[model samples]
Target: MDNLPISSKYRSRPLEPLGDAEREQLAERLNDEFARGGIDTDAYRAMLDQVFAANTLGEVASVVASLPAKDTFAVPVVIETGTAAPGELLPARTTGLRAPLLLVAGLGTGIAVAILLVVLIIL
Candidate 1:
């Protein structure tokens, strides 16, 4: 069998200081990779700006680390369209349900938890 090249040897890029064209190429490649990874383009651009603002290689690495890690799992989105029979009242209401329900439930839960915690501390 023929000998195969080492993966590390193929993977390593030259470490010489980047020139203007090289920097632009690198940025383009990074943006492409970010987009392919399903990242928000605007957020990635903001992160790129932060990376450029970094003075040192270490600072750039820190900026990269500070950006949220790419999501590992792909969630398949299901768009559901409901059609009700003519003149039938749909019990599930979408309008104003989300914010109001969430706010009320959160506030109620928080109050209950606070009361419980206070009672526990007193007892």
Candidate 2:
């Protein structure tokens, strides 16, 4: 028999911290395994403890791999970076505080300067 690796390993990163969302997902899957009798009571408790105590993605992954019926699951991620469609009725700008205030103040100053120039021209 040829000796081969049973699972893929994340070789590049050794200590990537797991995010809160991922941790919750791992805990949920652990619960499912426990409910389906894939994990015994003793082992289920231990794995639940490990899932919550896990600090890295690898830790949670290891727990998942130990399940009797392994899923080999990977969560899908979607990110939208494109702007809105053309002719779209986009909402008004709701950020920043100084730009509008400065514009109004500058307009007043410009009007004052224009009035001064007219008065001078008339004199």
Candidate 3:
């Protein structure tokens, strides 16, 4: 039986080895789950071991599969002081233009004439 080749089902490598970047990301995900108490110390250590030994992204994904997904977006809450903390993401600003534009358009010709009169009076 020594002459028999190893069975393919148990013998060869099927997945690429995990890289540093992927390892770091998996560690961070594991930390997030641990911090959230989703996994206890023993489980965290076990999963972390899996992450370090992981051969592929699929393996890393399986390691985190039992934990709740981490929230990707963080909304920064600001106080009335209006100063944002360091590293906080600022909310977007938009001009309040659309409502006034639609109102002016709907008022029709009489408002247009009145606006023209105001400009003429100013001139």
Top candidate, metric lDDT? 2
Tell me the tens digit of each residue's lDDT in model 3 across 22-49.
6887798889888988889998999899
State the lDDT of candidate 1 residue by residue for 4-107, as single tens digits: 12322111322333345534543565587686784577767876775565444333443334434435477778754569776677788567778999899999
Cα RMSDs, all models: 18.4, 11.2, 14.5
Ordered list by TM-score, greatest first:
2, 3, 1
Residue pairs with backbone overlap in model 1: none
Stretches of candidate 1 off by over 4 Å are 1-22, 63-123
Quantify all predictions' global Cα lDDT against the true fold: 0.55, 0.71, 0.70
Between the candidate structures 1 and 3, which one is better when assessed by TM-score? 3
Q: What is the TM-score of each candidate against the true structure?
A: 0.29, 0.45, 0.42
Estimate the lDDT of model 1: 0.55
Superposed by TM-score, candidate 2 places the C-alpha of residue 77 at a distance from the truth, in angstroms, of 17
